[model samples]
Target chain A: MIERNGLQSGSQDPAPEGALLPVVQVGRPADVPRGRADAARNRARVLDAAQALFAERGVQAVTMDDVARAAGVGKGTLYRGFGDRAGLAMALLDDRARAFQAAVLDGPAPLGPGAPADDRLVAFVLAYFRFQADHLELVLESEAGRGPGARLAKGSYRFWRQHVAWLLQEAGAPHAGTRAEVLLGALAADQVRHWLVVVGRPADAVAAELAAVARSLLR
Target chain B: MIERNGLQSGSQDPAPEGALLPVVQVGRPADVPRGRADAARNRARVLDAAQALFAERGVQAVTMDDVARAAGVGKGTLYRGFGDRAGLAMALLDDRARAFQAAVLDGPAPLGPGAPADDRLVAFVLAYFRFQADHLELVLESEAGRGPGARLAKGSYRFWRQHVAWLLQEAGAPHAGTRAEVLLGALAADQVRHWLVVVGRPADAVAAELAAVARSLLR
Candidate 1:
């Protein structure tokens, strides 16, 4: 239980809120889904081959047959492993996302916690933007068929929102829940891509401004 | 032009900025897409009939045949005009959306520009939520096939974003552009519906909290 600070009250940490620790589901034994070890190895080999092909020739030019040939696997194997081109793209996205989430959960300060609340908040926003900056194509590809405004429901998004909300509460911010939501939404990849790429703003400036805005919103 | 006083700064309205007038695409002679007047009337009649049917029986239960029968229009006319059942639903959504936008542009005080910028901002957030609350089904209907994160690109969203940005600039808020984007994103139909309906918070309280969050973000 996050101690209920009056939407306006203050609190020194209470001892009972163990489940609501600074570290979240991040450090838990990750439920990394897998198949038979040999089968999983074959899957990884196929994905690596597909990733290299995508990087070299671009997604549009690479076909399933090309992936099979590069992985040295049969077409039947590729077909059985991945339902289709889109499915393959999503699996690659999921593969990268796990690592990203892990880093945010347990790796380092600012992004991984143990920093001041404001600093942690700032780091999270910039980290999200940088991730999008580095992998715009993959991020966009993974989001291809989502319903309008389904953003709040994405698995990673729910975690980010909860993390931000908890941080804001710890900092004694009023309306922390809504503020965290707004902050996350503002840092959405689509908007970040637009501001960073299309609008030609320096990435650092946007991150700094976002940090300032986040501070302004906090009490 | 909108006066840019700090949220804590002072201003009795400065000289007018014509480009920044209260009226937007709202008061412009609405180009109601018209066919022959009689054709338009029949379209309206069919839509009204469809609306009643949808309200009486859920969307899934009501079919095109039923709509055509209720409207006294031939099945071919329904098919030609709407393309299919989902098309009819979208057309209905578009119809309501156009009205909503028009109201914001030209409607009475608080919602329109007659009120102070802060008041108008609050009204706009509440009004948006109410629109979603009243027509969740229609709004969701229109969003069915949208690509992920496409919410920011909707035609109405662009207009609302512009309107909110303009209001924020007028109110002397820092980072009006980014703040408005975040505010709008947080109030996205999906999040609003989840908090208000799924979470069982009273509509008014959520609206009030949203208004407070918007104000806090300003300056």
Candidate 2:
């Protein structure tokens, strides 16, 4: 299970040491226990509302005020929870990332543990491509100003890279680690945007092509 | 035969309409012809000096004043020729890019016209990886703050993408255009930096892995 690390103060925090490690807070103010449950509920509601609004109207058109109003929460609560629109986007991405991680960890075959490594690799590429295509706007917003390689520093990226490398290793691929980096580099958000948006390739077509490339690597 | 488009004014020019088209300048002041040749010589001298200084010391440590002094050009000439250090970096990269392009077009087999599609593709990837490894600093500096997808708009990127796509097509690969984008995406500057610098992979090893991936696509 993925641990919610709480809201990052800003999405641009430099790569923290052991960024993927789950740290449980040991102590807090006496009143904080009651507040934590409410805060979690509020955060979920805000993220749900933001996701719907972002889907309905593009990300740039939706404002923090709009998100707060739609979530039926105070603007103060929304701001306190997310800091800004980019922070909200990052949180939404984090939320989706955790869910995807869960699916890969414990869900079904192909993407989970049951399928052969090559099948799982193909499935992962297809699924991740869909995830990227679905959240392109949010990913771009969250990663803006952070350089291209900044994602490599994120826990989610480390997780993806490790998973891909493991799959390659399982398939007895030579230079698995290096090849995994190159494969994932091909899936970077900007590259996805270029393929799907700028080049106007169909999502299915792009995903299929990428999946083929993934399968090719297994050889 | 690459046409010198003269100084780009700045390297961050937005994707120009007919960006790769050759434009011929028609008219100038009576004295401008003499000034043009002098300007070309001065530009070459400054670039050579900057390249040497950058090679001697790292790109960051070499100042514009050092380049001007080393090249025997004044500070005004240095700034006038290259705008700033990033501009200078871009110009140097452009110079190298042109040379590479020429080699690919007219040089020997494997990288040139005589080789089979798969062989050419592998050769191109290997040669490009080496080019990227050697000039990582220059590429990063030239691309700073321009965003990750910014390179896609560059004429050089367009050229590379077209060449890869053509080679893929020659090999009868499906979805050649999309796959080429994916392949070139793997060779992105930041990705190369992450593999070579951050992850500490040997450049030759990375290049070999990438070449294998490229060759796999031909099947």
| Chain B, per-candidate TM-score | 0.68, 0.72
- The sequence of per-residue lDDT tens digits that candidate 2 reaches over residues B1-219 is 333433242232322421321122212122324346677788879878988999999887887789999999999887776655556777777646666776787789889899998889999999988988888998766655353366676556777888999999998887788778778878877788988888897888788888988877775
* Cα lDDT, model 1, residue A6: 19
List, residue by residue over A5-104, the lDDT tens digit for candidate 1.
3111001111121111222332333333334666566677888998999899876578789999999888877766654454466567653555677777
DockQ of 1: 0.36
For model 2, the stretches where C-alpha displacement exceeds 4 angstroms are A1-88, A144-148, B1-88, B143-148
The collision pairs in model 1 are B1-B16, B1-B17
Clashing pairs in 2: none
TM values, all candidates: 0.70, 0.73
Model 1 scores a TM of 0.70
Question: Which residues of candidate 1, in runs, are more than 4 Å off?
Answer: A1-34, A49-90, A94-99, A143-150, A196-202, B1-90, B94-99, B143-149
